[model samples]
Structure formats: C-alpha cells, structure tokens
Target: MSQHVLALPSPIDLAAAAFTLPLFSLVLAALIIAGTLFVPRLHNRAGGTASPTAPVTARYRPEHRALGISAIAVILVFAVENIVRGYLLNLSDIVEWWQYATPIFAAVLCLAMTLALIVLKGAHQPERPVVPTTRRTWLSFSPRAVLIGASAAFIALLGTTVAAGLASSSDDRGRFIYLEIPVPNTEIEPLRPWFYGWDFGVPVLICLAALAVVTWATLRRNAMRPYLRPETVTAERLARIQVASGAVSIATAAVLLALGGAFRFIGRSGSLSQLTIGNDDTIYDMVWKYAEFAAVARYLAPALEITGFVLLLFVAIRLLHRPTPEGHGLRPQPSAQPETVR
Candidate 1:
C-alpha cells in the first residue's frame, strides 16, 4: 500500500491544540462545583431515627464537599495558568524545564489541600477509643479501586517517561525527541514529536516521590484520629478516604492524561507523515519500526484517562451527594429516646 504523508503542525500549534483537554476539564470542574452547590438536595429514604453516625456525617459532609469542589478548582486554576503561561511566554514552541515541573506542582498542591481538609475535619472531633472496639484501619476503609488505579497510572506514567528518555536521540535546547529521521542519500532530516518525561523525568519523579510520602503520612494521621462512634465510623471514615482519594485520583489521572495525550498526539501525527519525505513509505516504515509504542499508546492513553476519571467521579459524587436520611432531610429535632443511643 502507498503511504500518505501529511504536514505536521509547528510545536506551538501542537501544544495549543493539546490544551483542549485541560480546557474541557476546567469547564467540567467548574460545572461540577456549581452543580454541587446550586442543585437542590434530594431525599430518597423514609422517616427513620438518625444513626449514631449521622451527626459525624452531617458535620464533615460539607467539608468533604468543599474538598471535592476545591480539588477540581485546583485543577481548573492550574490549567488556566498553564495555558496562559504557555501562550503568553511562547513556551509551547520550545521545550523548557518549567514545563515539566508545573504540572507536578499542581498535583502536589492539590494533595496538600486534601490533607489539610482531613486535618480540619478531625480537629474538633473526640479522640480515638482507649479500649479498641474494632480493628478497622484506614486501609480497610480506603477506596481500593481508586488507590490502585492511581498507583497504576503513576507507574505507567513513570514507565513511559523513562522509556522515552532512554529512546531520546537528540536534545536541542530544552526540546527532546526520541529520534530524528534522515532522508536516504540526502540532507533532509525530520524530528519526532514530544513525549512527557523525556530528558526531564528526574525532577518529575522526585516530585512524585515526595507526593507519595505526604499522602502516606497524612492518611496515617487520619487513621489515628478519633471517631464519634467507633462501630459506625466505617461510613464516615470511608467518606473521608474518598475525599482524599478522589482528589488524588483526579490529580494523578489528570497529569497522566495531559502529558500522555500530549506525547501520543504529537508522535502519532508526526509518524503518519513527514514534510521532507512526503508519501514515502520508507519514512513511515522507519517511524513504525522505531516508535512502535506509539501505536499502542494512541489508544491506551485515553482509555486509562477515562477510566481514572469515571471511577473517581463515581466515588466522589457518592460521597458528596450523599442521600439524606428521611428524618434528617428537613431539620434537627431531639429524638424521642434521647438516652436510647447506639
């Protein structure tokens, strides 16, 4: 079959086009915040006495809601700043060190906020039971799916970055490319598109390592905090875990999405055609032979991103838009049996 060559856009154009995902995400996050606040609360259960855990849920729910909102807000703000910085400074046309560090900074900031929210939620709560009634820990209540998925995504991002860095054949200024193709018996040569972590994975990896430490330490602190009711604390703790987990899941996935998508789109586009060797099957064959991973990444990047986002979104909404117990939907009233506690 004959190869069809197409002209690839400049670095500026490529990066500008790639900004679409972050832009869409920002808008979606804004809508999420608005919906969380403005949408009227709905009730689904019949009248029943509030559980021993109801007050804990009631007290922390708004804080978690704010956390959820703020998680997305951080993404939105960083995204805007990233876009503005790229365009105004014309950084999109060339590689720069700041490009790699900026996203990591955003993720770290989001994680810190989540930890702060957790601290704030437990500040006024009672201490843990002196006599252990249950053996439950943070791990038991944590959202395993989210934690696992985020961990996996982080590993995948690291792998791709390392692979790209190893494969890099040239670094012009700050821009790094996996390889450059030269026309047979000619002076013409072409550069491949950008991939995340190429020639700059060290700083990114360092930042990620710090994030992991912060997350572990904060969750540990959360586990040690007291509960309103030990037996009924599962729901409350799980909700708290979801708050931190959701933020983390979103942040990790967003970084992977932004960086991975940037890599794949540009690489795939460059592979499909070249300016110097238009419609030359040799060029296409060379690109495919050398950068075979792009073929798989084209699909994998988006699929992982969607999976992470959907999973996090489901759990986040579950925690944020909790179903109000029928009796608690309207207002507070003294239970008929005030002394008949759990």
Candidate 2:
C-alpha cells in the first residue's frame, strides 16, 4: 500500500480566514465614520430673522455626539475582541467554539450598541419644543417591510442553529469527522474528512437572545421619549432609523453568512468522504443522498457571504450620509415686512 500524503491548511491561515470579516467590519466602520466627520452639518431655516432666506446656524446636539461616540465604542470593542480571539487561536491547533461564534457575536453587539445609542439620543430630546406636539412611536418612523425582513432573518438564523446542532455529533467536537476506508487485501486503512457538525450553536443562540433584548428596549424607549414639532421629530427619527437600519442589515448578513458557512463545511465534508482509493472500496458509511444534499447546500455559501459584504458596504454608505435638516431649531421667525407710510 502506497502512503497517501495529504496537504492541509496551516492553523494561521485558518485563523486569518475566520477573523477576516470581523476585522473588515471594524476597519470599514472606522473609515466611514472618519470620512463623515468632513461632511458639514445642515442647518434649519431661520425664523424671525432679518433675512428669511438665510440659513440658521447649526446647533450641535448632544444626542448626535453621543451616537457618534457609541459607534466608535462599538468598533473599538470589536477590535479588542478580535485581538483576544487571535491570541486564543494561536495557543491551540484545535478549532474552538469561540472561533465560530466570533463574527455573529460581533454582529449582535453592533445591533445592541446601535439600539442603545438610539435610546440615548431620544433621552437627550429638549424638554420644550418650539410648538406643542403629540408623542410618536418608534414604529411610526420605522419601515414595516424592513422590520418584517429583519424578523424573518432572525427566525431563519434560529432555525439554522437548531439544524446545525441536531446534525452535529458530539464526538467530533466542531471539526469535520474522519472516516476509515480500507483498501481490499491490505490491513491498511486511511482516514479522510467526512461529515461536519457545529458544537458552537449554543453560543450563537445566546447572542441572539441578547439581540432580542436590545431591540425590545430600543423600541420601548423610542416610543416613550418626548416629541418635538413634526419637522424636528421627523429629522431626528430619520437619523435614528438610518442608524438602526444599518445595524439590522449587518445583523441579517451575519445570519446568512453563518448559515452559509455551516452548509458549506457540511457539504465539503460529505463530498470529500466519497473519495475512493481503489475501484472497489468498502467505505459506504456516509449516506449518498445526504452528501449530495450538502454538496448542493455548499453552493449557497459564496452567495451568502457576498450578500453579507454588500450589506457591510451599505452600512459604510449609511454612516457617510448625514441627515438633512427638515426645519429650523425654533419656529421660523416671521420675515420683516416693508414698513408702509401710515
């Protein structure tokens, strides 16, 4: 029997691939935010000014500053998380559960931080408005289709996690299983990669729980905050909604990418297990149909990851956009009229 030498990936390469998305997210957010600093803030039309056409001086709201700070905090925390994970990955050759959980966890953290900042922004609303206005719910500002899509994506994530847990065997840990195949007339048996299962589903589920909690709090807080005039209220809500939308988009992308990764690995394992050294081999342990299913499933991975990357870029674009002013800070002052000889 000839010795079969197989080439395998180094631990460092695998670690780098695992961390690529997270690092990309952090850098992208930072660059976009930094670029946004150059964009000038818009001012509302002046009221009771000598010139009605003149623009009012822009008032820097504390809420905007707080929101910006929170965004910065998110990327910083994620950077720290990547550093720790890289250290841990370096310490061991074995794939750990945390490695798989890292990107999804970062996505969830982003969502939570974004929502928390929105709530903080609402808290800083001025007590007195230029005109009396009724309190408005956050739902009024939110796009219903987007909310529905986000919910669906979250539910799909849960379903995928459950499927991964059920499909995974505890004995293999998180790595793909190796099966022994024998060459006839010889005592030699070769081990090859086979079925894949995820043991880190529980950690992902926990992250999802945190995400749900944060989303609930944001909605509740936004509805309870005092309202300003329709014009002011609309602009603020739009800003909040844009931020929130970006968060949701990234979260949804995370879910898709996670599902795709799980499917891809499972399919690859299944397909690789079908390798035969001789024409008549006796390693029929894997179900042919299941392997085929996984093979088909793997095709979805690239598409999912691409979609996720697009969403990340969308987040960058959203961050670069500053909200336009809908109205002046105070009611438009009456324009000076030409004094007539009386």
Candidate 3:
C-alpha cells in the first residue's frame, strides 16, 4: 500500500454532523432578544431626540404588536444557535455537520425576503389580485411555487456540501481545495488585517447599504405609530421580519465565509493533523495521513457566527431608538395613498 492514505473520518461522528433544529431554534431566539436589549441601550445614551418627520420613523403604530413579537422571537433563536455552535461545539462535529446550518441560513434569507414581499404584496394587492390565466401573474402570486423554489435551493446546497466534503480541501500545490485558501493555514503574514478589508470590500458595501435601508425603514415606520393610527399589522410585520430575518442571514453568511477561510487556511498551512475521522480499518491508516484539518475548520465556523451578531448590533443601534418621555422612539404616519381622503 502507498505510504499516504486519507485519514478515515470520525466513525463516531456522524458524517453529516450539525446542530439539530432545536439548537437553531434557540439561536434565533437569542439574536432577537439581543436586538431588543441593544437598541434601547444605544439610544439611552444619545439623549437628544431624532427627527420624526423623516420616512425613517414612519410606521410605529400599536397595531403591529403581534408581528413584532413573533419576529423578535424567531431572530432571538438564530442568535442563540450561532453562539452555541461557535462557542460550544467541537471542531470535528462542525466539519461533518456544517451542511445542516446551510438550510437554517436559507430559511432566514427567505424569511427576510418574504417580509419584503409581504410589504410589496399589500401595496399591490388591491389593484392587482389576479383572475389570471397568464404566466407572470400566476408565478408572482403563487406561494406554492415560491416554496418549491426555496426547497429546491436548499436541497441543492446540501448536495454541494456532500461533494465538497468528499473531495480534499487541499489542492495539487496543497492549498485549500477550490478556494486556493492560504496554505500553512496560518503563515500569519499573508493573512494580515489589511487583506480583510480588500477581500470583504464589495460584500461589505452591499451589506452596509442593506443595513442602512433596514435601519431607516424600521425607524421611520416604527416612529410614526401615533400619526398612522393603529399601525397596519402587515406593515409592522414586514418591518420586524425584515430586521429579524436579516440578522440571522448575516450570522449564517458570516459563518460560511469563515469556513471558506478556514479550509483555505488548511490548504496553505499544510496542517491536517486534526481531522482523524473514520472507522477502525481507516482509523489507523488515516492516522499516518496527517492532513486532517477538521479542527481548524471548526475554529473558523464561530467567527462567522460572531460577525452576524456584530452586524445585528450595528443595525439595531441605528434604527431602534430608545424609548423615553423625551424620546423619538416610534412615530406613526399616513401612507402616501390614503385609504380615505376628504
């Protein structure tokens, strides 16, 4: 037999390891709670009031009570899950199970997108409810179709993880597979702080713009509650869902990016001493291989989750102003096309 053999993966470890739905359920909960606590804390220090007339604080009616509560609850669970995965889980477990988190991420993304859709749907509903035999209208209104597409994407991503996992995370030159991730996994020099800005530069910009829009929309809508009078539940739900879902999406995306980096790191560093996973026959054979960087991958996963939290904190501060007597917390205002105009 050749001197080199692939380390058998951890037989004890489920090849498809990851947190169960129950864990993710908790993560979503924590993030939403963190947002709730964080906003008030940020604004309490500012003291000076913000402008209510701006579109930023235009939708704060009392009627959205239920939507707001539910969104917050869901987001909180995402937060908790990320934290536990990053802080508590072992490295081997993560690599084997990273695939599972992907679905949760997709779900969060859909939630946010749906929230936006809900807003659009309501605005267009009266004028556009279709008695249509046409394709465009049919696709647009079909919730079933939307669910099917999302499910397909989820299934596709699962396939991708399997393919990637089976293949080496390294290359011919021995860099992380596919990504050319830095080798030595940690030469430290090339992985310097300056490079982070360049790598994340474009995504950062896109995320920032999205962040601004999210903040402005939430604040403006929530602030205008009184003027709007018993806020439209749909609008309020949309706003909360947008923020909550966005929070989890950021969390999941960050963690995935971290995984990409870690894999690349293993490639560059030439260190796979950690992945010793496999059955008894492969276990001994796998030991000599020494290129199992599963631990490294695990370490990187948490970083992604952390990034999610920071983003949430940043957005919350910008939008959800603290409530006080001298506060500009939430103001309600009229929509451009009033239901009844004298």
Candidate 4:
C-alpha cells in the first residue's frame, strides 16, 4: 500500500486570498450601505398613492415595497456572509462548500427576483389609444440622457481597455500561465485575445445595449404619454424599472472593467518578471506595478458603482414625486356630448 500525502497551498495563493477578502468586503459594505439608504426610501414611496382613487396603484404598492425589501435583504445577507467567510478563511485552512456556492446562490436570487418582477401581477393595464406627439428633447437633468451618456462612457472605456491590452507587448499571442500540480514540468498556455474580449467586452456591450433599450423606452413612453395606461404603466413605474435595471447594469460593468484592468496589469507584470528575472530589478518591482494599479481599481470601481446607484436613486425619487398632468388622473373625464339644436 502506498501512502498519499496532501500538499499545502502556495504562499502566493494564500496572499492572494488575503488581499481579495478585504477588497470584496469593502465592495459589499458599499453595496449594503447604498441599499439600506435607497431601498427604504423606495419602499416608503411605493405606499404613497399616485391618485386618490387609483385602486390599481394601491394594490401594486405592496408588491413594489416587497421587491425593494427583498433586494435590500439579499444585500444584507451577502454582506454578512462575506464578513463571515473572511473570518473563517483566517481561522481554517479547509474551504467549505458553502463558501464556493455563495456566488451561485447570489446569482440565483438575482435571477429569481428579476423573474418575479417580470411576471408579477399589475404590470399591464388597459391600453388608452391617444395620438403620439413629439416633445422637444433636453439633455439637462434627464434620466434618459444620463443612461445614454453612461452607456456611451462604458463603451468608450471598453474600447480603451481593449486597445491597451492589444498594444501591450505582453499580450502577444501564445502567452499565458496554466497551473499544473503533481507534474513538475508544465509550459505556459496561450491566453488568446478572445478570452479577454469575451470576459470584459461582452459584458460592457450587453450593458450598453440594455441602457440603449431603456433610453428608447423612456423616450417612447414620454412621447406616447396619453396613450399609456395611467393606472398601471405610469411614468413612475417605468422609471422604477429603469433604476433597478440601471443599477445592476452599472455595477456589473464597473466590476467587469475593474477585473479586466487588474488582469491586464497582472499579465503585464508577469511578462515583465519573466524578462527581468536575471536583471538588477527583481520581480518585486513588476509586482509593485500591479499592486499600484489594483489599488486604484479597488477604490475607483466601488466609487463608480456607488455613484451610479445614487444617480438611479435620485431618478427614481424624482419620478415618484412628479405631479400628475391634467386629465391624467384615475377618474376618467366625461366626454362632452354634441350640442343638439333646440
């Protein structure tokens, strides 16, 4: 019988774990704080009546409030779980299955929440046919404008990141490191350009498309205002949906961008280390460069996400408080009869 020996993890892997735990904790804290501030406000506003006799609005309020509460609850749970995981990682060498499954659980919750919002009752109302009119477009203080601008900025950032990666000598074809255990000899695998594009580029483009669609919907809904059902599909409802979707999209894009930037920096450092191994400057210099870049990304990514969340909250509040236009209330106006000749 041959005895088996278990090898311990590398120091570098442990160091990376320690670094990521704090970084993730900070991001989660930011998200939880933001949700705590905004979700309650949204929930409160959901209870307010848009019109005195709007039964549909009254009935829909509870569900809206529930959705807001559920979202906030999820964030709270995620934050708590993250903190616990960080603590446990420090205490024990053994990784639990739940730690690995946390992300999968979070993703499932998000998908379920999205599906609930989509299939939830009170989404549709009887369509009111009215003539559509064009309104003068103004970019100032407009949610649609903000979304469009943000989408464009994300696209631009994606392009810049791609260009940066492409121009890097380190990014030359057939240059990647793959880890192999037990076997002493292993060659570095090729990190194809498509991998970077697929990881970062696809997400940015998807978010861009989502923002574009939301912007279009906003414009269409505003232009066809008299035609949309006032009781159910109000401007405020549309704004709420947009805010939720926008927050998700913005956060996702920022995270992906940060990850892509960090990876590119690390890749460059790895390549530099390989080149400067026997030189006067050691690999630590290359590592320092990556650390500096990652530090900037750590703060910048959260700031961007928080800013987007705040902006969306502001938009949602504005839409919720917007005054109902004349003839747009729940009570239908009496149609004037043709005057008969006496």
Instruction: Give the winner by TM-score.
Output: 1
What CA root-mean-square deviation does each model show from the true structure? 7.9, 10.0, 15.5, 11.8
* Residue 322, candidate 1: alpha-carbon lDDT: 54
lDDT of 3: 0.36
Which portions of model 1 miss their true places by more than 4 Å? Answer: 1-52, 85-89, 96-104, 120-130, 133-138, 172-178, 182-197, 231-235, 265-290, 304-342
lDDT string, candidate 3, 1-342, tens digits? 669878876855542343222343235434654655557664443222342422323442221222233234434655555567767876541222332343244334433443453354334223222232222221222234423533343333333344343433333443323322233433322211111111222233343334334433433333222223223322433344333333333333333333333333333333322222345343211121323544444444444444444443433333344344445434443533232210
State the lDDT of candidate 2 residue by residue for 138-160, as single tens digits. Answer: 56445677678768867866876
Candidate 1 overall lDDT versus native: 0.53
Off by over 4 Å in 2: 1-93, 129-138, 172-198, 278-285, 323-342
For model 1, how does the per-residue alpha-carbon lDDT over 64-124 read when each residue is reduced to its tens digit? Answer: 6664564455445555675777567766455554445455566566667667766776677
Q: Give residue 227's lDDT in candidate 1 (0 to 100).
A: 61
Highest lDDT: give the candidate number. Answer: 1
What is candidate 4's lDDT per residue for 169-260, written digit by digit as tens?
A: 32234332111111113233322222223233334344445444444443333222232343333433343443344334333333333433
Q: What does candidate 2 score in Cα RMSD to the true structure?
A: 10.0
Residue ranges of candidate 4 with Cα displaced over 4 Å: 1-53, 56-145, 168-299, 305-342
Q: What C-alpha lDDT values do all the predictions have?
A: 0.53, 0.50, 0.36, 0.39
Q: lDDT at 174 for candidate 4?
A: 37
How many residue pairs in model 2 have overlapping backbones?
A: 3
lDDT of 4: 0.39
Look at candidate 4 and tell me the lDDT of residue 288. Answer: 25
